[model samples]
Target: MPAEKPSHFGASARRLVGRLAPYRMYIAISVALTIGGVVLSTLGPKILGRATDYVFAGLIGRNLPAGATVEEVVAGLRAQGKDTFADLVAGTPYLVPGQGIDFDALARVIMQVLALYLVAALLMWISVRLVNRISMWTVRDLRSDAEDQVHRLPLSYFDKQPRGEVLSRVTNDLDNVQQVLQQTFGQLLSAAVTVVAILAMMLWISPVLTIIAVLTIPVSVLVTVLIASRSQKLFKAQWAHTGTLNGQVEEAFTGHELVRVFGRREQVTARMREVNEELFDVTWRAQFISGVIMPAMFFIGNLGYVLVAVVGGLRVATGTLSLGSVQAFIQYSRQFTQPVTQVASMANQLQSGVASAERVFELLDEEPQVPDPVDTPPVSASRGRVEFEDVTFSYGPEPLIEDLSLVAEPGQTVAIVGPTGAGKTTLVNLIMRFYELDAGRITLDGRDITSMTRHDLRERIGMVLQDAWTFEGSIRDNIAYGRPGATDAEVHAAAQAAYVDRFVQHLPGGYDTVLDDEGSTVSVGEKQLITIARAFISQPSLLILDEATSSVDTRTELLVQEAMARLRTDRTSFVIAHRLSTIRDADLILVMEQGRIVEQGTHTGLLAAGGAYARLHAAQFRGAAVQVDAEKQAGEVPGAPG
Candidate 1:
């Protein structure tokens, strides 16, 4: 069984950061841009405040006369050590005693404000772009790694988990992480920088006012911390519920027919509804708490701002604080509170991303089963001979095969036949090393099968199973799947031998006809033929046919059997057949029952002995002509052979 995922959200965050290690340049650029934007925004407010102070000092403190010329106003401020025209207006009074200040300097202030916005906008854009690009690249790598892991993982790993849940980890979890990357990273960085710069500027202008504004900091941090701590666990629960819900949906879709046949749709639906409701509840509570962070911070922020203004106003009226400094303090207060609010808003997104990252990393941390041996030598040459010596096997607690001994010499056809519950299929699985043997060893030619690299062992084997799987592709594509570099002529020939060429020729696009998912557009028999064509195209040194022709109609089965015969000529073969007649001409027939070889002999020998093989043969054919006759009879019927 696979390992369980960790519940900690911080683990996911650390994992996400690790993935970003490859893109240091992008991350650094993004941080730089974010800080630049925050700095510019913080400076804008201070510049406006300074300009207000200059205007007040020039008009009211200096008492400029009515209709004072711009030169006179500047001269008065210059005598007071505010020499620049820009500075004179910045400290001018709003209400002049005799004359109003000129609109020219106000226009300059507006231009400066406009310049600040333009620069800040560019910085914000760069920051957003960098964050988005970095995140997308990270997501791409993560998704690719997940997909590669799926292929490299042992097939047995899939047996214990639902397909939907596995998909949810890659799809839904990754998507959530991507959202976090794109949104939260930028916002959090910018907010932190903005808050720091604004607070510094506020304190620089007036430490007393800065302290007053910061009174809400502890309260806001306490609320955010509490909300964030609870939100992380809820977010983890949300992700888990999502996986469970997806699992249920997947199970329903895959077993639609079964549910209908068994009249259990209501049972399945009720169960799924329960899971779905739980998912909704989990997400709702999590989002609700996370959602409160922003508004709660905003409220505290407004309250803090009001307090700062009330206290600063009294100090200004008492002639202890300058109006310009008080005005600057208000802007700084907004800056400090705004980022804390932003941080609160971003907390859930970051936590959720961390949760997903943890899950993805856990999958990456899984150790692959059947690890390649260190310094293992490659096989010089692979002979088709295969042997099972005192082989014993079990899946979990039940023994599927025990004390099994068998061998197929090079260029020999060994048929395995038995009842439905017999271990014939398990024997083939043992040979393939899909499951390790609990006792004894299996050898290929002179080498233990286990000693050979799985890649090397599998490369020499061709398989055609009872249910042949095909991806959505053209007829030619399916045939060439096993041998990716095979030529068109080789593919056509393999298709012709498997009888798939006959069907392909009738399609509108011939060999180029596109297939639907699971190749459902094709007949079951035709799909089986395609699988055979794929196996034939590979030209493997050894072949295993597990009820290979069981799905094909009589005529197609004959063509397939003929193809199998030709393919088996120079290769060792293991034929696991449900129908006894199919293996009568095999060089050796081993009858398996309850994980043991009950009988072994020629067709006549088994028939004469009236052993397990004879009984199985009787059950399948009732002593009728064994080979093609049963197949011929099956064609006249509508369903698969018993």
Candidate 2:
């Protein structure tokens, strides 16, 4: 049974963050630099306050007692405004216009400001470097793990879902997580620490003023919290719709031939337009709602600043504060808002990041239907004997192959001929352990294939699938795919056996010619030959050919058939075909329909039996190549070159 899927994303996140704990030293360094950067920033305002106090002292030519308060200065000025204290403020002489300025004190303040700026810049540089390194490394680890999971997943998982949809999760969805890890995660960490530090500093400076300044904190925080919670769902929906849009585009492009043949181009385009519109609406709403965070923080923050100014100014007028202290308090008021706004904005980004993280985690959480067992025994080669005993299989809810039993001896060719959807391919999949049988045993050399590791079992079998894919590489490389370390001589020998050597020798680059995507530059028949050559190079104990000659010309088919004869001399072979003519010479033929074998015998025996095999053979191969040619000329099916 598969493991239960996780319901709470928070647990998954904590798990992911735990993986980062190994980088504690780097994280500490980054945090220290950020704190230094913030502290240096605070110094700028402190220096400005000192400069203000000095300028006032120089104008009056009176030295203030150490630790004097701005409120006392304000009270003295007010007293002078009233009576006996009037001459106190008036007696202070002002500096002559254009006279020498207080260069020494001004220079010291400027130098201190520059020093703070320099320290802030240096700390920021170090912090960014450490943070970015951690982020990039985390992304790399995540993507690699996701890709490994995809390769290990059961084939049935792919059968039930579109290729494009699965691909979008790895590509686009992971990219979203990468953006969060690389760009947003570090900022969130720094913002959080800075906000805490500022709030602590505000409370320390003056609890009364701090309380007044933070009057809007709860309201501002509540609003951002509400918005973030709502945007989480919206962002998740936006990502899902984006994936749907991408899947539609991929499907339309891959199946353009069908779309054009059926004249449904406009219909597909209209559907795509609708999908795009849905995605646009979802994205717009998510982003617009998220956008309100910063501005709301700013509104509350500015209101706090105004409140501080009013209260502090009155305290100074009442002789309770010093000019320098008022300046420092005002500066602190501005400083307090910055980290608050920073954290509020980060809440929005964090919501989006969490949404993407949930999607990525979903893929990680999927349980492969048939996981490779820890105690799986390794398999070695033997006389190629395969047996299926009462095997029953299904994609999921619908059973595709049921109560099937068959055997293939060493050095024999067994052909599976069936109507479409009659479980021919599924049989091969069962032998390869691509899908687990619902009920029954498939064995190789008297050992159950399920008891052996997938890698160990598959290593002994060679397959040339109906839809063979040729990766972008040189012709020689494609042929050598069956055995990675195969020499040039081995590659050439396989190519010669498959008759692909004839085409290779004629090309300008001979064996080095490049095969483009899906081998589109080569003819379909030639690509089939190359695929056969790749299988031949593997030299496995058993060979499975799934419609290997279906797309080739008559001359090409004969050549491949001759090669097939040599390749099958010591190995067991299972051939699947639809055209009937290709498998007439098999040692055994099984006619399958509706997931059951309706008839089984040799060509002459089945012909004498006059069963399902005879009926299909008579109708399909009455005139052999001539009937096929007629169908091709009439455009009923695609034709291969002679």
Candidate 3:
């Protein structure tokens, strides 16, 4: 079954943080640099304030140097034995009251402030680079773990979910996580450091002003909590709707031919419109609620700013606070509020990221396939023999197969014929252990099938399905997929046996032609031939052919039948055929209805007995005879044959 969707944000967040365990050193360095940068940045306003104080002092006729007197100048010149000193002091400002400003000292202070800012910029750049590296690597590991988890999940999990929805969890959901980690993580960290550093600097400047500035922090937090709480459900709904929308698009496009044939364009578009509308609704609501946080925070921050300015002005007038200190405090107030606003803005992204993480963690936490026993022995070589004794199974509460017993000895071809929904494919699945049986046991060569590893059991069986899937690769590669290390000659031999060589030789790049994702470059019949060739290359002891030639033309069916005959020559084969002619030569034929064997015999024996199989065969041939007669009557002239 598909995994339950995760709803616990705290657990998911913890899991996301746990991904950083391997990169602790890198994260530590990043944090250190961030702190250093914030500390240096906080020093800028204070240092500039010092420069302001110096300019004020110089302008107000305080702490200026005294001008050199004529005697003092002559003594300095005699002591130094140089006239340059007199020239330097001739137009120099005096360090005395009512003198010019100390331009040299002011220049030095400005340069000091500039240098601190430059260092801070460099540290912030390095820190951001480190953060990028850490986030990207963490996401890489996350994607890898999710992919490995997918491989461990049972087929039933896939059976229950839409392919696109599952894919969204793996791709779009991970992309969301990556975006948050890459962009929001650094911002949040910087905001935190900035807020703390700015607070410290503010307190140092004026405790009262610091208290006034910090009054907005609680209000901002409270507003943020309320809005974010409301938006969390909206964000979750938004992603879920997005996944559903993606699923619809994927299904519609995948079955494009069917849609066109059935003229479902209007219906499909209308359905997608509904889902799109739903997605848009939740998306906008989430954005609007989260968006309110920043401006609200700004409003409260501005109120605090007004309070600080008014209170600081009063203190300054009372001579308790310096003008420079007030200037610094005002700058500190803006700086402090800025980080809070930034953090408030990131609240939405953080919420979205947590939602995505929850989805990903759900996939990771799904129950994996049952594991093999620790001391499971390797499969021993055996003559092909399969047995199902009182086997029972079900998809739900209703039993699909019950008390089903069958046997196929080595070199025997057992043909299974049935109508649709008669558990034909389910039987194949059960035999392959794709789904564990609810009751009874199956054995191969006297050894219980469950005792063998799935890998070992699957290695001994080859399947060719009706769909005939092929990947994007050369034809040679597709054929060799069944046995990866097969030689080129072996591949050619298999292709020749399967009649794939007939068409492949005519192509521009014989056996080397690359196919697209669906292998649509070739006809369906040709694709089926390629799949048969793939099965040929495997050379398994047991073979399962499930409606393998049901989709092909008569001529292609002939070729496929010939290939299948060769494939089943020395193996125990189970053939599920809709066309009775294809299995007329089987050693045993089982006719199934409602998931139970209604009759079991060879074709002639069943015909002579006039049972269910005989009735079905008669109906098919009777239809064929009537069609032939109709064609003959249409082709005949008035009196030509008489």
lDDT of 3 at 136: 89
Q: Which stretches of candidate 2 lie over 4 Å from their true place?
A: 1-16, 60-102, 375-378, 623-642
Candidate 3 lDDT score at position 11 = 78
Q: What count of clashes does model 3 give?
A: 6
| Model 3 C-alpha lDDT versus the unseen true structure | 0.84
lDDT per residue as tens, model 3, 44-107: 9988877766665466434223464544653665577755443333323332344556788889
lDDT of 3 at 45: 94
For model 1, the superposed segments whose C-alpha errors exceed 4 Å read: 1-3, 54-99, 623-642
Q: Could you tell which candidate, 2 or 3, scores higher by lDDT?
A: 3
Worst 10 residues of 1 by lDDT: 633-642
Write candidate 2's Cα lDDT for 120-183 as tens digits. 9899788988988887677677788789888878876676666776777788877776676666
C-alpha lDDT of residue 637 in model 2 = 31
Best by TM-score: 3
Ordered by lDDT, highest first, the candidates read 3, 1, 2
Model 1 scores a TM of 0.89
**Candidate whose lDDT is highest:** 3
Model 1, 49-81: lDDT tens digits are 757765665466345566775556656767877
Q: lDDT (0-100) at residue 592 of candidate 2?
A: 79
